[model samples]
Target: MSDNSSKLHQRAVYLRNLLIAHVTGRSVNEADYHKLRHYFMGHKDTSRIIPSVLEKHPDLSDLWQMMKYNYASHEDRKAFIDSEFSPFLAKLSPDSSQPSQALLSQNQFIDEPTLLKHWLKANEMLEMNPPVASEQMKVLLEKLCHQILRELKVVPDPRQHDLTPLVSLTERSLLLSPGKQHYLVVKALVAGCSEAMSAIDNLTAEGISVITDQAAIPKIDKPTSLVLINLYGSLASMLLSGWRVRQMLVEGNSQR
Candidate 1:
């Protein structure tokens, strides 16, 4: 397995063991509530693949709330782990070994500078430096849009800076019209990707605090960045796949 795949597998194993300990054993109190907070802090990337954990216990600070004074949430949290997480973890066992990105074929990412290089750089800094990684994702998406336009023999609009405009331009170039059977679904997916790009834009840049109405927004975390990265890769794959179909159709028509 590739190094990224190995890391993903290790993370899956660790999380499974952690959850099992909580759900199993003699009693609920036997579980270490403090470890829950530690897991979130240390493994921020967990939510990238297994987001349900964060969905259940989003407030990391609240893990500390389960200290000696309070034990009300312990049983409830354990139950969630048993019902939702256990099954997911079971699939991740070394025998099965299915990570989120496992569904994506390796051929989707070519060994080019604009594509794989930036993705690797961004992933390296994903946990340690989320802001930097987020910036890389933006650049990757922008460059990909530019490349797609170039491949179509069209001049990309220099004014189209952000992802949404570039994506709209890409769609226009690809003839993503409303008359198609799956047009609505494709449009919705494209729109969702655009929204993800916008969300990434909102993430803290260069460690700079994002302030709104005198309130500072939380800095971009690993899980959020990873999700955006996954989304970007998926969108890139979709665009390229459509472009390839168009290219073949054009070649066939020209040959006729």
Candidate 2:
């Protein structure tokens, strides 16, 4: 299966199981909770069928509501997850009937161990300590950029603290030729990853926690942090996976 398709199928199964777990009563895992929140709650653009499903199941809807307000501070609590959750996750083979593929993919981090380690750590601290997670995210981005540059035998400037320049350099390093057909998508992915990280950086800086109100204007709260972090994971992992494919093609050509 194509990488993207594999990711989507794996994600669907993962969220489906998470939903089953929620109805069954389980500790609201921070990663799992935020993932579901982004997919089903605030995102109106999600598949219409999903909302219809929720409409039919008030039990699921009520569980989601409790999660929005009182449960944000409690990662050990539970909620619901829908989609866009799987894109950032590591790719899993289709037969891996294990719905825990999300955690399995996370543990594999597969290509980049250090980046994955920091990413997982940041995920764990989202509810308990968002600021620290944000800081770790910055560090994760830096490590990713430096790793990409180093792979191309290019020395990344240690003084560059901002993510844009670093991400741009990594993108260029990943695809040395602007004329390459895949260059545009690679550039877009890198740019998206950088911008999303910037948003996360800003939002997490303001201190995101379990704050909710239907009447009040939305601020950078715990829900937003979870959503954006998951976005960051998707963009970054897709970029890395693409880079891996490029390397494999290069290796195959060399062997011939």
Candidate 3:
């Protein structure tokens, strides 16, 4: 077998054993391990089997414990295994093999000029009439909430799901070295969004026309608005930083 094939075969066997050990609470004997290894190494459809094995054994505590036993630091073990397994797991699933290009595109930062244009349009509508402008702003905020959830990989269900926890998770996942300001801003944005969604639900329940009835328009508190603006600014900075990093990598590769 080719070197790559051999490596894949070994990994597959290793993962299979780990799953078995997890489910049964007993390690596979060396003889059986070798037997399974050889069988899978010679099998034509090993790639197809790996995902099935993983899916059947969704609880990964055994494998995690094994990694912890081998590595001293919690962070070290997590980083190492995630880096190793993510690629292998992606290979087993057709949908995950390629990155979500559409999602990535949608999450890219809107430029200052584009943002200014939107602001001008919103202002014009407000100037013409409050009701029309209130409706437009409501739609805009709802869209923003959807966009943020999508970027954070959360499937939004305003009526069914309590989004506060998911927002907390998103904040934890995205902010690597958040400061005091970051904490306060993220907290405000999450609370504000939640409040706005709740108000929407209440208005709808009361049969209030959110578009026509000015009373139905959700009032965004000053702190929430300020925090949301800061959040957008931070997102823009992150996008710019990522762009610069990618450019540097490309330049380095070309030079090499």
Kindly report which residue stretches of model 1 are placed more than 4 angstroms away from their true locations once superposed.
1-121, 176-218
Give the per-residue lDDT of model 3 (tens digit) for 11-78: 44244423334333343334433344344445576634444333332345544466546755432442
In terms of lDDT, the poorest run of 10 residues in model 1 is: 98-107
lDDT of each: 0.49, 0.48, 0.38
Q: What is the alpha-carbon lDDT for the whole of candidate 3? A: 0.38
Clash pairs (backbone) in predicted model 2: 27-77, 28-75, 28-76, 28-77, 28-78, 36-81, 88-234
Tell me the alpha-carbon RMSD of every candidate. 18.8, 16.2, 19.6
lDDT of 2 by residue, 121-207 (tens): 567756543433443454345445555666678765644434566776676677675336556665565545556656656755764
Q: After superposition, how far is residue 169 of candidate 1 from its true place, in Å?
A: 1.2
Ranking of all predicted structures according to TM-score, beginning with the best and ending with the worst: 2, 1, 3
Give the least accurate 10-residue stretch of model 2, judged by summed lDDT: 209-218
| Residue-level lDDT tens digits of model 1 in 1-256 | 3544334443443343344344323222212333433443455544344636534554434433442144334333444444554444434333344232221121233324445555665676575445435544654565566666767777755433346777767766766433354455445544455565565456534653333222222245678778766666666766655566565566766798
TM-score comparison, 1 vs 2, better candidate: 2
RMSD of 3: 19.6
